[model samples]
Target: DRGPVPVEEGQEVDVTVDSVGRRGDGIARFNNFVIFVPGTNAGDKVKVRITSVRNNFATGEVVKGE
Candidate 1:
């Protein structure tokens, strides 16, 4: 079951790169939360460090290499 989460802003998380966006960011998911990672592409395994959190989406940076 889905429980309440207490993830803070700017929190780092690990996720798999799923696909790329038109703006060139990478799409990843962590704990069922979707995040957009900059400087990354599709099909790349990466670790994303959260940069911003919104109501429905999140933004992050790649902690690992491309």
Candidate 2:
């Protein structure tokens, strides 16, 4: 069984974009959980605010880049 998701809606976290999704969103992993962040690219280190969280993945918006 899976543990609880590492992020929640409205939470801000730092992440490094590991890859790009098919639609071009940046993909980051937090504690092995997937987070899709828009307006970012692969190799980018960014601060993102969690917008939505699902069972398997989460979505976030870029707050800033590092």
Candidate 3:
């Protein structure tokens, strides 16, 4: 069972990196929802564009320093 996805494709949002996942991606939250972003680390703040959205989580790319 899953809830409605809070984000849509190409949506840009800002989040604070909370931790690193097993694949070395930075994990952050939007409204307590999880998003994984590569090339980021814990304590890093960034803006991301949503690339994919799944049932429980989403994937995004860092668009910072742009």
- lDDT: which candidate is best? 2
Q: Which ten residues in a row have the lowest lDDT in candidate 3?
A: 1-10
Most accurate candidate by TM-score: 2
Locate the minimum summed-lDDT window of 10 residues in model 1. Answer: 1-10
Task: Give candidates' CA RMSD values in order.
Answer: 2.6, 0.7, 1.7
Give lDDT tens digits, candidate 1, residues 1-66: 345443457677767888988898888877776788888877787767778877666898777764
- Candidate 2 residue pairs in clash (backbone atoms < 3 Å): none
- Please provide TM-scores, in order, for all candidate models, with all chains considered together: 0.77, 0.95, 0.91
Better of 1 and 3 by lDDT: 3
Q: Rate the local accuracy (lDDT) of all candidates.
A: 0.75, 0.93, 0.91
lDDT for residue 18 in candidate 2, whole number 0-100? 99
Candidate 2: regions farther than 4 A off? none
What overall lDDT, based on C-alpha atoms, would model 1 receive against the true structure? 0.75
Residue 1 accuracy (lDDT) in model 2? 57
RMSD of 1: 2.6
- In candidate 3, what are the lDDT values of residues 1-66, reduced to their tens digit? 546788988999999989999999999999878999999999999999999988889999999923
What is the Cα-based TM-score of model 2? 0.95
